[model samples]
Target: MTVSAPIASRADAGGGTPQALLRLDAVGRRFGDTVAVDGVSLEVPAGEFLTLLGPSGCGKTTTLRMIAGFEHPTSGRVLIGGRDVTALPPQKRDVGMVFQNYALFPHLDVWENVAFGLKSRGERGAGVEAAVTRALGLVELEPYARRKVQALSGGQQQRVALARALAPEPPVLLLDEPLSNLDAALRERTRDELRALLKRLGMTAVFVTHDQEEAFALSDRIAVMDRGRLQQVGSPEALYGAPVNAFVASFLGRANFLPATVDSVDGDRAACTVAAGVTWRARLAADSPRGAGARVRLMARPEALTLAAADEPNALRARVLDRRFAGAATFYRMETEAGPELLVQGGPHTASPGDVAGICLVESAQPVAYAAEP
Candidate 1:
């Protein structure tokens, strides 16, 4: 997957690299006194799947609307294929949008619904038919093209919306939680199908969702937003492994934050004392305090911790409080002697509730330390 970068121009300064097909240059929007989006800039290379991920009302949907020309930005520009389209209307822009509701016409059948966009653009007769056929074929809904959208399943209705969007052959596609209506099992299967369909079509897509798992599964790169501001943008693994801040760390997954003080700093590493004489070496984040004695919090994911012998080096003495079986893995809730409770993910039936256990960071775990918030 191609990673996204902040490219202001069509290509790099030297014009040696492939141009970004979509660019949002410091775009912003306001609803009276409330800022919906603030100075969000991003560049998406052709065929890259970029997801805007955040909690509710974090400006992801607003950003998507700006790209789709449904809403105009109060400041900055929107560009597609290197051309500024900030002032263009929805139909004038070469982009397709799959709305959250699927927005299928109840009166129309799948074939007519899929042909709606093409027909609205003044396509006539066989041209419209061919485009609709091709779009349905792409989504493997050709057999049900004559079926009314109301008769289709939630997953199939979503495909009709996608087919309608694709019939226009837009270079850029915008998806706004297209799978939100489906059941959990169906959503998972549909997302896989959606990603495969988009990749096969070489579509440059911008997806908006609050679900981190969906973002992780579908995106080549994720742009995390918060409080109407862009926080960080990177590949899923990059963002998950080395988040820029506490918000990103906690939002991307379950993180255990232990209050600690920095004992020392050696380059990018920090020795942090979580409790009296209990020090753990952690990777220092960019904004982490450098000097010794600085208050900080050590962050470790549940999966990064393992059960160990009580006397093992760097192990924290803990007692298993409870356990939950979760299919492939079991989760253990433990309270450390250091006063912090931690969650650890391990194999099945390792320890039961009331069992005294030792919690240690796994070898591959490089815990991060962040300067404690005021």
Candidate 2:
């Protein structure tokens, strides 16, 4: 059974020194000739929600399976609370896992399903009843406790699965794309509820998802993976505002990459020339080298480029090509006189197609720069 109560008393529930609750040291997994996960090392501190985010076939699911003891790593160690449990089976690992499919028993009611683990693990009589009730209440599903799994809505069924997994209150929770099966709106709502619930319980969790928005919404930190390797790991803001590479920048959010040649460097900022007369300042990645005549890429979000007066500094003459109207924002596709296309985000555009305008890069907004791809 999952360990519901704290295994040991922590100094603080959620605000301690951020002790490592889970650690993966150089973990690797191989399936025949294919390398599923390659030398991934990560440490998830107590009460911090970390996400393994990537596209399909990126080894995110493989990594999560390894941690859950569903798949053994070909190399390295998996530790929980300073205990090496690399060779332990899933049941012995003290982890509660919620899979993509709810994995609920169709014949069992919500209460019985949630109570299965507890009862099987020797919890009896009043203890099993109380634990099931508490778990159902946590998911706000007590009213549906008698309902069959197939009779519930997708969201309700998700709640039941969550309740079942949480009934054991394992010190660490492993969720593998738990919301992926729901509709978009339900997924959003469920993710919000999941984040709120985990935070309230101060539970340490490792979530895996390919949905960038979901990862940003629910994780304290995200580890972006690609092709069986970790690309970057950081807080949502840090990853979005200051991506270490092109993949991280493009993967995290919408970014418009502009090719440039570095003209000069001063400290963490550099001057780059995008065109014959268009020179702009951009922030370099923290560990990137500063040098003259270096080829680099400047990344700006759609919102970072706004309509400006024709005479404004760093403004480029462009003609609107198309406009996409989103609910809260409008995206404009424009072609610059300097021969580059740009996307600018605004609300209710004043300029129509074929209208010439000045698109200015926000001077104070330090766009992220990285070494250009070969």
- Model 2 worst lDDT window (10 residues): 2-11
Identify the leading candidate in terms of lDDT.
1
What TM-score does each of the candidates earn? Answer: 0.94, 0.93
Residue pairs of candidate 1 with colliding backbone atoms:
none
Give lDDT tens digits, candidate 1, residues 278-374. Answer: 6888999988889999999899999989997767777888999999998988999999998889999997878888988788878888999998989
The all-Cα superposition gives candidate 2 an RMSD in Å to the true structure of 2.8
Off by over 4 Å in 2: 1-15, 286-289, 309-313
Per residue, candidate 2 scores C-alpha lDDT tens digits across 257-297 of 88888899988899888876778889898645578988888
